[model samples]
Target: MDDDIPTRMFYAGRRWQVTDMPTRIRDSVWATEPGTGRGFYGWRFQATDETGESFVFDVYPGAEGWHVHHCYA
Candidate 1:
């Protein structure tokens, strides 16, 4: 997993700039079903923006690339 990477995201109809490098908060692997198939890996992060607001974000690998799953300010 990549750490301390700068990223940008569009949320709530606005673009949020990740002012600082993102820090990994947690990591997890979960199965698609109950002991049925291969699982997926994901990560959570915490970042602070230029406005001094802290935000929580998540990212996961996909067909395209690492996608920003969600964020909370």
Candidate 2:
């Protein structure tokens, strides 16, 4: 995906084994690796700008490499 694109992204559930993340805070935005609370890990984040636009963002492990998706509302 284009890095310049501004959108909202966030973890859906308790991704990874880590319960607390410094990135997960009410501020500008953040990103993290999503996991099954044990094995494997992926990337997720929420992006927004001063405009207030938002998009649900998530990246999962793919056969070739990493697959990312952005949902807008």
Candidate 3:
């Protein structure tokens, strides 16, 4: 008595599983938490892509500013 049952089953059969790999740079949130005034003063790291391309990221609080960490290959 339910014509909508067949339509719902058709879409459920085509869903696939996710199999992507994780990044090596391993980014994370390093900001000051709520109700707190002190946290990571500065943080930096060099990241390499899957193709061996390298890049850097530097994070600092307030007026410190960001700078490249530098990397090879």
Identify the leading candidate in terms of TM-score. 1
Misplaced by over 4 Å in model 2 are 1-38, 48-53, 69-72
lDDT tens digits by residue: candidate 1, 8-68: 6554555556655565533334555656656555556565555657677777668977666
Q: What is the lDDT of candidate 3?
A: 0.31
Residue lDDT tens for model 2, 1-73: 3353222333343232212221212212222433323433444455443455544445555577544544344
lDDT of 1: 0.59
- Clashing residue pairs found in predicted model 3: none
TM-score-based ranking: 1, 2, 3
Which lDDT tens digits does candidate 3 get at residues 1-39? 023111111111232121222122212344356445544
Model 1: residues with Cα > 4 Å off, grouped in runs: 1-29
Q: TM-score of predicted model 1? A: 0.49
Superior candidate under TM-score, 1 versus 3: 1
Candidate 3 worst ten-residue window by lDDT: 4-13
Q: How accurate locally, in lDDT, is each candidate? A: 0.59, 0.38, 0.31
How many pairs of residues collide in each model? 0, 8, 0
User: Could you give me the TM-score of model 2 versus the true structure?
Assistant: 0.29
